[model samples]
Target: MAGRRNGHAGRPRVGVLALQGDFREHAEILERLGAEPVEVRRPEDLRGLDGLIIPGGESTAIGNLMVHSGMLDAIRSFFYQGGAVWGTCAGMVLAASATTGPSQPLLGIMSALVERNGFGRQVHSFEADLEVKGFDRPFRGVFIRAPYFEDVGPGVEVLAEIDGRVVAARAGKVLVTAFHPELTDDTRFHEYFLREVCGSDERS
Candidate 1:
C-alpha cells in the first residue's frame, strides 16, 4: 500500500506494452494517479517495472511482436518473479492460455480460457452499464468487438459480468478485463489494478 492518509505512495513504476493500441490513455490515467507508467516495446522494457499493463489492440499482432522481440519470455519472467500484471480487451486475449481461434502464441501467464469476438462483430460493439465489485456507481463498459472469458481455471476469480458471461477476472496478482477501461474516465478499475497488481500509491 502506498503511504498516505490519502495520496499515492512509494516509487512505483508500471509498464504498458506499446506493441499495440490504447496504451497512451492507460499511461495517462496512471500518471494522474501519481504512478510512473513506461511504454514497453521490447524485452529490455520489462526490467525495473513493478507491474505491467497489456493494452487493448489486435492480440495477434501483439503476440507476434512479443515473440519476435523476446518479450513473451520477458513477461512470463516478470510474473514468475511475483511481479503483477493487468490485461484489458486485447490484453485479455494475449493473457489467455486457450483462445477461440488458432492457437496463437501468448505469455500464457493467466489461468483463463477466452473466446475472441464472443461479443459479436465490429458493428455489435456496444456500451453497457456494469456493476463491478469494489466500485460505487455503475461503470459504463465500452466493448469494441470485445472477447469474453469462458472456462476459467480453478485459480481465477470472476470480478464482473454481463448476461452470464465473464468480463473481468483476477487471480492473485493478475487482472484482466474484456472491456476497454481506458475508454472511460472511471478510475476504479485502474485503481484496483494499481493496488492489487502494481502496488502503486493510493489516491485521495
Candidate 2:
C-alpha cells in the first residue's frame, strides 16, 4: 500500500475534495499532522496524491459537482489502485454502494448501505465519545447532519458505534466516519488511516 510517489520531499500527499464541503478543515488538520494536503477542485487535481478525504457537506450537491467535473470515475479508480480514502458525513453517503431515502450518486467504493442524515436534522446535532476498534481511548465524534450505516457488506469492518448504530467503518483501504472527526482536536483517526489504511509512515 505504498503511496504513489510524487516527489513531495518524502511526505505523503493527501488530497481533500474541495467541490462542496468542509474541505479546508480537513486540509488544515492534514497540514498540522505533517502531511501535505492539496485542495482538489478538478479531476486533474487528483493526480499523484497518496490519499484523499471527502469531507462532510450536502451529498447531492457534492455528487452533482463530481459528475459534472468528471471525477466520479477517477475517484473509483484511485480506490481500486490501493489508494486510501476517508469519507466523513456526506462523504460517507458518496462512498457507499447503496443508500436509503431516495437515490443519490455514489462512487460504490465501499460495500455498505447508508441512510443520509440518519442522525436527524442540524438542530439534532450532538457530540459523543466513540469507542473505536483500534483506539485505546474513546474518540470524540461530532455529528452534524450525519449519516449512519444501516447495513455493511461482508468485507466491511465496523469500527465505532453509538447506541448500537454503526457510525464508523473500514473496507479494504477505505475508511468512513459518520461524524466529523476533523472538527475535533483528536488526530488518532487520521493517524490510523495513514499508518494502517495507506500503509504510510505516521509523522510525529
TM-score of each: 0.91, 0.93
Candidate 1 lDDT by residue in tens digits, 1-204 = 642212335647889998878999999999998788999988888877778899988888888888888989999988777678899988898888888788888777777789988898789999999888777889899998899887788788788899888999887778899999899988888888877655633111
Whole-model alpha-carbon lDDT for candidate 2: 0.85
RMSD of each: 4.3, 3.3
RMSD versus native structure for model 1: 4.3
Query: Where is model 1 poorest over a 10-residue stretch in terms of lDDT?
Result: 2-11
Deviation (Å) of 163 in candidate 2? 2.0
| Residue-wise C-alpha lDDT for candidate 2, range 70-155, written one tens digit per residue | 88888988777656789999999999999888887899988888999998999999999889998999999999999999998888
Q: Which regions of candidate 2 are displaced past 4 Å?
A: 1-9, 200-204
Residue 125 displacement in candidate 1 (angstroms): 0.8
Each model's lDDT: 0.82, 0.85
Q: After superposing candidate 1 on the true structure, give the runs of residues whose Cα lies further than 4 Å from its correct spot.
A: 2-9, 200-204
Looking at model 1, residue 95 earns an lDDT score of 84
Best by lDDT: 2
